[model samples]
Target: MTSLPMSDYYFRQFEHDGADAPAGRKGRIFSAICQGDAPTRKKLATDMALRPATVSDLVMELIHDGLITESRPAQSLQKGRPEILLTPAPGRLCAVIFHFVSHTMHCAVVDLAGTILFETTEQVQADKIDKQGFIDVLSSLAGKCTAHIPGSAKQCGYALSLPGIVDEPGKRWVYSAYWPKLSDFDLSEVSETLGHDVIVRKNLNCELRARTSRRKSLGTGKTLLIHWGIGIGAAFISNDRELVLTEGFGEIGHCVLDPLSTVSCKCGMIGCMEAEAGLWALATMSQDQSIPINEQKFEDYLQDCTDKSFLKRPLLLMAHTLRNLTLTLMPDEIVLTGPFVQCPETFQRLTERFELIFPEGALVRKGRKPKIVSGRRSKSDELVGAAFDLFRTEIGALCRI
Candidate 1:
């Protein structure tokens, strides 16, 4: 997930229709604008390595197509003339984002330019919502959201931030212990029934995509993002890659920590890291300690809980798991995201212990240890990421046209 350099124009795949068609450069320009840089004609030409006149022609075409909106920046103190800034138009393009979490589905309508136009959350009893019933619920929800879209906006389609390991190539769910009904479910078959072209992806990967979009620069180089929330969802990134939407991609949650530990993961695996270090592990410990599960102020509770020795073992175990993952993957950066990792001391202790255990002198003695940084977008990174990914897709498609 290396940050795409502005000079790189291959972010999208565009078939050259003919000599009459706009080339890949057209897509490149549009993508850059959609990034919200609002580059002027001169800046766009410089970034894309095109003549100013060529950029002007593409800008005009894009403007004509309602793909971008141009506005003159107010007078600047250092500049001789005002430059027209190009930006993605609100309501011109949109996508429906559906995130399945717990017994609820968090839904939002997001614009291509990164605006959440509408959002709602609905709860369904997991036991009652069977596979067909779940699909029906999602279909009904999608219809409700789409109905609210402005008539002028172009609907790019629907994207799902599913809870399980999504086999995008196979269009099926590999496993989801919490939502067992979706295991081995064929999403493509349901896509037709839902009446929309769908993009199915693992929620972890969606969060990582959204995280990378916010940090367009950090997308550069190899990175491993660990969402240490209610569950541990692991995602990796390389340059110019789709979110890891494959079977067993996010199953790091099933990574067994202690072969003999009594803890059990929701996946029915004994001693899995999810059972040891996931939010459930913390919650279990809290319950055993007679601590109140303050859902409303969990972050504050986490800060207070970690100060005591009761939560140290799980945090330590979590750190060990992350260290194992780091050594295995050897990414440039490992992002500690999700609610559990938000505690500053918890994050600091994890990184400090990881650095001690994973030293070059002790381990490989080759490359540097990956830098650990906290995740941005504390709330709804998964939901926003789902929309951001689709927004980029829409921009790429629009550019190709």
Candidate 2:
């Protein structure tokens, strides 16, 4: 790993207001308890690498705050005092993860401990619904999700993951190829109606955010996730841990590959990667609407799709894109996810291509090959990352009141 003069707070997603600075230790202790099975104070101390007395002190703070509860010790046959188990208070902290898929929104209410309390989906005909209709649906879902959680549960906030250009700084969906009418739609509108601080991000970026390691690592801070859902998109985490999602990050799909090609993209570009390799492109190029455009189907269907060598051009274009990204950006890790990358053959080919081209960068530095691999989590686990984004934010506040 290249030693960057980066801050301890490397990841941008972990940055938050200083409201909870006083509760930093309490938050870490609470977060640690939320991780594995209920841990004893001694175990917590070992896990967090803190002194036994320090853990005992924080445990009381958490217990007093109603964030955790000590379970009655089990009968120990050989030991003197049975270790008391520390467990998170049931439903103490919860957040709703709104995962926006093509034409459908999967809403999941998750606790600080990463348990899904409730899950429901809302679908809309993209061609029919206006931007306001979309926001209304989100607002309604937030209310329904909030109501489902026990009143005692602290509803921290909402993490909304959507497709399209996420102007994170401005906090709005700047442009959406899937929902053309949703351009420049203010995200704060949903926050205002829902009365929650909404965390809006590119669905893929949220996937990256969600997958980030709780335990800071050498390479975890630098990652680039390339996703293939209805369209092609990329999310980047700089070495210093700043997530790159806004400022022309949306145009990856519209990047022109073949300037003279005839096919046009949904974003109105000709011969873009989305025009050739995206799910929409696959459907358009093959003229098969019956094909399931998801990760599960990609493995078997990929063989069928490749029967006619139908995947060659798209995969080649995709390899071209990754090659350029690897050369220029050189992120610590490049993760591939979504339906297309799920295919064994597709995944293998991408990895092999990266292996071949990634070495070319050695001319710059003896043999510095960046990791390029498939994402570890499935789509369902994406909500885990989304909830963690909020969890990380809340933890940073030291204990936001």
Q: lDDT by residue for model 1 over 234-332, one digit each (tens)?
A: 888664544343456657777776778888676776888777766656677564564433322556676666355665776777777777877787678
Compute each candidate's TM-score over C-alphas: 0.79, 0.78
Candidate 1 residue runs with Cα over 4 Å from true position: 1-22, 32-57, 70-87, 216-220, 239-247, 281-300, 306-312, 376-381
| Model 2 lDDT per residue over 1-401, tens place | 11111113322322253323443556656655655577889887776677899789878877876777888656656567788888767467778888866678778898755678988888888757887788788878877787799877877788877777777656788766678788787877677788888887667665665555433775535677887666788877664455555556745787876788888766665777787788766866686666665545654576567463666777778887887776667677778877667677777877776566556555764565667777644554566666655655655564433
Candidate with maximal TM-score:
1
What TM-score would you give candidate 2 relative to the actual structure?
Answer: 0.78
